[model samples]
Target: MLTVDEHGLTVSAPWRSSERRIVGVIRDAEDWVLKKLDVWNAFPARKQTWTQDDRIRYLGRDLSLELTQDTIASLATLRDGDRLQISLADPTHTDSVKAAVVKWYRRHALANFIDRIGALAPRLEVPVPRLFLSSARTRWGSCNARREVRLNWRLIQAAQPTIDYVVVHELAHLLEMNHSRRFWKIVASVAPHYREACAELNRMGLYYMDI
Candidate 1:
């Protein structure tokens, strides 16, 4: 389960386990969060180390990793690396705030993608599944059998070419679900520089969380 620190305004995810790992995030002078741990019920002791990389850390804790102060700084700095607007809606609870901010980003990103698809579909003679913002870790975007498309909201943080390439790729799949030669022909016709965008998008994972 997830819980926000009432006093510090921190986001926490706790698991049922013997070892406990707690993570925290400091949003600003007025806000900080201490997330609870969620894992198995038992664990052994372990050594701990610190780093400046701005990531979660775990020390002598069963979960093995917790969010560190440096990680919070990193998250704040990452809000708009690609020039997209940064907006976060945090709930009163700490854990809810993390979920809320993520959901807000995803919803808005999906809305923008859908709007763009509507504008481009008629001109290009290609249609795609309705785009939905989601926290899908395995893919930047997906096309289902029902002609529905799911896109990661984090795509908004990527470059424009990356976003466009994914959109075009998903749309092409609506015509041909498989990545066959015909599929490439359709995508290439719409986005001549898609290969470059795909390459960059593939690298974006290095910079973000599961979203």
Candidate 2:
């Protein structure tokens, strides 16, 4: 099997598979591999420094970071719908700033995910699952036999439509656990544009992992 991610392409083959056969397989899929690579290459560089005036993605929009010293507690807040004001004892400390911002993201992610799940679950005729935040680097969301749902907190950075696609996907799994045609049809019933959202999520997955 061949897979592509932020780190680029990887090939997993049986131990008995010859190197020549692997090469041939890669050659056969050259166009697809290059297209996937191009998607990653076209992404803008991720932020390296968490400092004042830095931009952070929130719900598909860019919010500028505004740092302030608070001596008492580290706090992060959204202001004017475009600025993220973060206050910490040491405003200049990048790690502290990042932590505060991440804390804020996780807190809001839970609320947002819960709301989406609640809103979409009834449409799918499933009870709202117990929601949890995930720090996973690869998966966006998952649903288990116990009806529990875990969504990557970083996905809070994606657009609402993309977020909805993941929610609908997991909820659909409550009815059809496998990715068979029936499962996809269930997802399509609620999120008709899921294919577009899935493509967008794939292209942006690596960028989200950088956070």
Candidate 3:
């Protein structure tokens, strides 16, 4: 949903369900503001369970995760040999104490990966979708036939291979529109062990989600 300040009202995203608890507060300001209801509340909700840096934080309930910092750093914890490092901030250990760093990492991670994909795109002759960072609560990545991609920024909390799998999977769509045999073939061609990588992503989900 979008909250417009210039018009002094809230504009909801047509795709959102009316039953969903979405609120918009528009106050007078110099510039126009259009904030998504979900994105605005992506903090505190998921703060208690996960230990993220200043990267991203889910606000109210299932809201969008906020990304507060930029630079990525390696964490000490290991989720199956992969270091749980967030490029956002050190939530548990830092002078800038705040909610989980997953928020910032979520936003920046996609931006970083998209750039990496740009380099990798030409190499594999794959079509790259125009991705924008968002604080979506449910999904990690989404694609449209129009070549537009919207990915959840919270993915920064995930493992590196998992991140690659998502990007590669999306890119593979440029060849195959759906999850068909040809799609798996293309994905496997580039990422030989994609099946294992996919399983790792699912396992990693437990560490990040709220109960």
Candidate 4:
């Protein structure tokens, strides 16, 4: 896959292909790639300015940030209503704003993961071996043979139902290591509307990739 974003173009070359082979392909398509880059650079991105016009989404809800001072440094917490308030040592700094926002997401993502797993594991009759957060590019959740579950931290931006679906899906792997009929059956037992959730998840490709 070729993806162009704020980080510039990314080429996901085939693994089996040699570096030399990929470089040859890039050389052949250099002009086309440059043209695409010109077009991509012209595209407008959403302005997430920290002042009056900034807003972001959490759990499918739009919210603005409110900067505040606190005894502790560099913290952002989701408060009631449409404001995600942050308390940082230097709230005026643009870098601090971004860091605080990410901190908030990581904090809540962990909380959400713990909550969902705590609630669903017992109901699914599976032991919650361990939980970890991942910033993996291509996977939402995973379960190893050892039963440790790792969920994408970006999932905190998705709705609770969607998060539950992923939680149930990975937990099912503890019961069935492979994606056999029995594995999906276990997922369905916990999340009855898993098909819809799966379809919705597929439809929202890279939605959780937002910062």
Highest-scoring model, TM-score: 2
Q: How close is candidate 1 to the true structure, as a TM-score?
A: 0.52
For candidate 4, give the lDDT: 0.74
lDDT of 1: 0.50
What's the candidate order when arranged by decreasing lDDT? 2, 4, 3, 1
Off by over 4 Å in 4: 1-47, 50-53, 68-72
* Deviating ranges (above 4 Å) for candidate 2: 1-45
In Å, residue 47's CA in model 4 sits off its true spot by 5.3
On a 0 to 1 TM-score scale, where does candidate 4 land against the true structure?
Answer: 0.71
lDDT of every model, 2 decimals:
0.50, 0.86, 0.52, 0.74
Worst 10 residues of 1 by lDDT: 57-66
Q: Candidate 3 vs. truth: CA RMSD? A: 13.3
List model 3 lDDT by residue over 128-175, tens digit each.
Answer: 658777555445666778877666566666556666666777778777
lDDT of 3 at 8: 26
126 in model 3: Cα distance from truth in Å?
2.6
Query: How many angstroms is residue 29 displaced in model 3 relative to the true structure, after the best TM-score fit?
Result: 54
Task: Identify the runs in model 1 with alpha carbons over 4 angstroms from their true place.
Answer: 1-97, 209-211
Best candidate, lDDT: 2
Better of 1 and 2 by lDDT: 2
Model 2, residue 209: C-alpha shift (Å): 1.3
Shift in Å, residue 71, candidate 4: 8.9
